[model samples]
Target: MSASIAARNIAGVVLLGLGLAVGSTGAPAVAATTVHTGVATQLGPCPTPTEAPGTEPIPFPLTSSVKPTDTSTSTVIVPDGPQMQCSTTAPTLYEDITYSSPTTGGVETDLKLDLQIPDTPGDKPLVIYITGGGFITADKSANLGQRTYVADQGYAVASIEYRTQLTGATYEDGLADVKSAVRYLRAHADEYGIDASQVAVWGQSAGGYLAAMAGATNGIKRFDIGENLNQSSSVQAVVDEFGASDLAGMADDYDAATQTAYMAPGSFINNYVFGPGSTRTVATDARANRAANPATYLRRGVSAPVVMLHGDQDQIVSPSQTLTYLNALKAKGVEGTRYVVQGANHGDMSFLGDPDAGLLWSTQKVMDVITGFLDQKIGS
Candidate 1:
């Protein structure tokens, strides 16, 4: 028996979880705690629609001869549907609240967020969720129902709207909008029952890129302009789900057809990101993308802990993007984790354990990966 090993378990796995540090072996830094029900598939906190036909195997002594009967005529059959009420503690939603009003794309529009605060009182960590729409339509409400999983974890989940190309927003403007949302939350923390000091950013695709940039550029004065000057726009954690990392090199990861499409003049990826319309040249466009890269700002201490998740089946932003981002993280000595969800596509909620949704991965597993990391980082 070794005395040094005696302090810890000798037979089980030993993990050195420093925030979101993925080991060199590339396993998930945080393994979710699974609760096994009697059924094989229901290893989550909530009950799924499946239960392998329950039966009382061991019969009790005949205290009373009982027989089941349908006593109520009110029982009615409904059409086939996949929705199941998982929790009674519904979050308090504050919808379409104006956070910032910036004139982007020549249109001065009020950017808003739909905040979901848990039913439990007291302060909780705020997760600023940024939606992805390829920078063409960054809607605040897309996949909003999927966000409830994050909110149900006793955290305030704010789905924010950032200005996109539709609003004539450049990558810089979009980043500013995301950061401004953070400052707004801090300035009005008391009203929302949020622990402003403990804040995180979670985004998908383009939103993911912005979220990563926000986390990587913490303490920098450039993007901290606009609302709530008194408060800092720094976030403690970041979750980049299938986001574009290195914009300049991203085209290289695409297939020949996609690369051609991406490089085509006036392409939305070109027009919205780098060069506008026919004005885009390869050199100038790549320069703009390089400027928007989070790696440009990532520093060891300045960047928040980040956990980048990607689906292996993602066709839009190739899975290699996560690796590219992770390489940048390693170069800066920043703490980062990489998690690839098998059978999961891009940011499509349709595949989240619903027959209509395609049932790629159980929603419980996804939320556990996301909220679990948030819990480790800034969870109250």
Candidate 2:
């Protein structure tokens, strides 16, 4: 079946399910699953600057500074596979590193992330990976091998879990989680021997949306939430793969008639932007929709360099999303690169290789492109 047809069928079924759910419960129900079982760490304030802003700089003699010692280790278990070729060595994996952030209700939620550090480490650059599931379901385990492969390449890789629509979380909540995770990692960079200034954020599908938001609003105050407020959540680079850059525009383009259908409230696209149980039109809330869009944050001096990968045949997020975002970046004089994978559908592994070769081959090919891009932008 063609990807577009498959996506439309899936959308119909999902809308039907949502309708039934609303009918039975009279409201959107939050999933009962508990996100975390432990108390979250409390981060302290940022250190005061030595000198006042706009003050004349003090002159000091240039001297050699000793680099911090490397004493960190990884615990990731490596399986023998073709993907192993991406990394020459195994990385130490630290699972379930928890960080706390507040939801719209101001209630604390414990967010978890998995960190994979290269066994052979200096002050390595870091990359935070966000998984794609249309903002409804996904976890740190979604792309374990790819993450480990990156870690093995002399970088620290972190896979994070953010609240989803099922948890009654909106796009804003998810974006906040991404920023908070960056802050948490920076706050403890010394413990892991990470070069905090060289951090990059990468994500796929829904995760890509969050990654784009993080990159565009690198220093924006509104998205900065949770602990470690003193720490800058700004990332130096971003890799967005098949993610939506503009929520309102994409929704209107995807299925304008269905987007306003009574059952469309249950659709993933609507729920992600408007929150669960929403009945308002996506275009109705222009300000909220614009705030959620990464394009809104793109400006001449405020955005980070971005590399975007999208499938021309993507059924969920159309290629126009990337084109529109790239155009905006260009207009603002922001640096960015876009690669449209031919004959590929939404999240299709075939874009990486021949369909007959299987996922392992395709994954390795994709990894090469990603690593090469990282090497140029942030230095792998």
Candidate 3:
């Protein structure tokens, strides 16, 4: 049989195999699907930030993401193959880090961050990075190679993790975790050994979504926390790599099989973060979920500079998703810097070849854009 026919046959079996009957091919098939299922379990919820208007800037106790009681469960996953290690010989710098948040009840989560500070750090600024895996998988360790490469360019780098495994099933919950993480970094400025005011955010996939939302919604009236944390969490720049920006819009465009994966277990973002009763619907549990969408949040104002990178042939998150967001930003006079990695698929490791080519091409340019923004904002 042909590839399309083989796909159809396999799809039919998978659906029927999962207790779903094969629908008739007589009528036209629509991409939009209605999911009737129970909850998708993943990480627990992150605490909410309370607005504290007219109150003095409280010196909140800080928390570091690293914990003494915690144990290392797994080493970094080398992208090319099994034997290749990510970051061993690369130089590493240390910084005393801590953050405090009302969500954690003012008790800091013992955060000990390792900085990959370059030799020439006076002019170079930092990019506070968060890695992505549907907001459940991956961590600071897995990004060792990427961090090491970016650090070689004279930029100070910090890899961070917030209350991980969040109920990212909704925008409100996911963004709340992001907000708290940024606030934590700001709260412990002196400890991290960098100017907190000059920080820019960057991430891959879902992390990209969080970074985009942080910059897009910064200082907005809707998502503000009435505390000093609110002011500190604001980002001066952002770099988003093929993340889903518009939840409702993306859901409306998702292919059948991807939607199936989404409706399945362990697909945290789709299963728990969105779906039936979430904010994507008007009659869902709370308005905060739908309002959590970054696409809906984009508007004219003091918008921060942004650099977006995506693979033109990305099968997971469509290119249209990035285009829609970039268009919206440009319409508002934001004019974000963009580069579509030609023929590249989502998260492919091919771009990392040719070490002599340097870090100004491919996705590495993302870190460069961030470094330039920080130079303009902080180093100036």
Candidate 4:
């Protein structure tokens, strides 16, 4: 079945970028936005940057969409797959390093991680990449490609393994596993040539959800369980791309058609996080979603700098999910930046083999926006 249920021949789609500044409690909401709104026209080759890299800059102005305009009635088939990230020809620095081993219901599962170091020297900032597999499978081996790209930009990348519902683990348990990975890295920072202070959590889809959760609950003791209790799990940066912020609200964001498709079968968000029999959109007042909401734990002083990206055209995970999370965060007086990519779908689900879509969202220009945020906040 096709992931997207939205009409293909969309008209006058708006492509814009919003940079929000949300201050502490009792503060007002402020924003600095530069929007290039029109039918998507240009999408290829990174435009020449006027300023230096790693600054607060949206390197590529989103003017037009690479998505082809279909005049006649049309249906799109997005080949489902992992996110299309940078190349990873570089060898692994370390692999299969167990970060946590937690026994649940008298069963023990060893959670391991693989690290990728750059060919260039220096103790590098670390990016803990959480793999996305609908939360039923957390494979550290997938998306190993992004490691080399990040490392080449003077950062180290570590893909970690976390417990999924398939292992009878809850969402909280998965989050705890992420914290354990951070603490473990900090404990052995020097040994691994990492700068513990400069760490970021970057993930796609479900991984993005966990990444946001980690940042929202940074340094919170309850999530820190087993090994390296002395070290902190708080990260300096967070990158969440098309992750579900509100579980039930996610269904609410879907249109009638999309909801029908999403609730059809194999609904991971329902089965894994919200539980089975929840294969339906929920009302906004359903506070049950707050239970696992990362934004629910956001504190002004505690939460790290966050950079959120989403595809406006995504049907799997609506861009509104990002807004819901970020808006909730802003109301609490925290700060974050949101970049909405036009014509892109959730992760690579809709654009796996589509080169135009690939160039639109996963190019070096896009990576620069990400690495730039990391550099400004974490000094990688």
Question: What lDDT score belongs to each candidate, Candidate 1 first?
Answer: 0.64, 0.63, 0.47, 0.63
Candidate 2 residue lDDT tens string, 1-380:
44433433333322111000001112112122333222222332111223221211111111111111111211111111333344444566677677654555555566777787776647889899987765776466655556666766778888888887777888887888888888888888888789988889989878888899999988888887677788888888888877888766653334444434422445566777777777754566778768778888887766888888765545456556777788778888988877765444555332222232223223455566678777777774
Better of 1 and 4 by lDDT: 1
* Model 2 misplaced regions, further than 4 Å: 1-11, 14-84, 104-107, 251-263, 348-364
Q: What TM-score would each prediction reach against the true structure?
A: 0.74, 0.74, 0.60, 0.72
* Better-scoring candidate (TM-score), 3 or 4: 4
Predictions: Cα RMSD each: 19.4, 17.1, 18.2, 14.0
For model 3, the superposed segments whose C-alpha errors exceed 4 Å read: 1-91, 95-114, 121-124, 164-170, 221-231, 251-254, 260-267, 272-290, 348-380
Q: What stretches of model 4 exceed 4 Å from their correct place?
A: 1-92, 260-267, 274-285, 350-359
Candidate 3 C-alpha lDDT tens digits along 196-259: 6676777777677778888888776444332334345667788777677665444333455554
**Best prediction by lDDT:** 1
Deviation of model 1 at 127, angstroms: 0.2
Clash count, candidate 4: 3
Per-residue error (Å), model 3, residue 26 = 63
* Model 3 / residue 159 / CA error / Å: 1.5
For candidate 4, the 10 contiguous residues with the lowest summed lDDT are 16-25
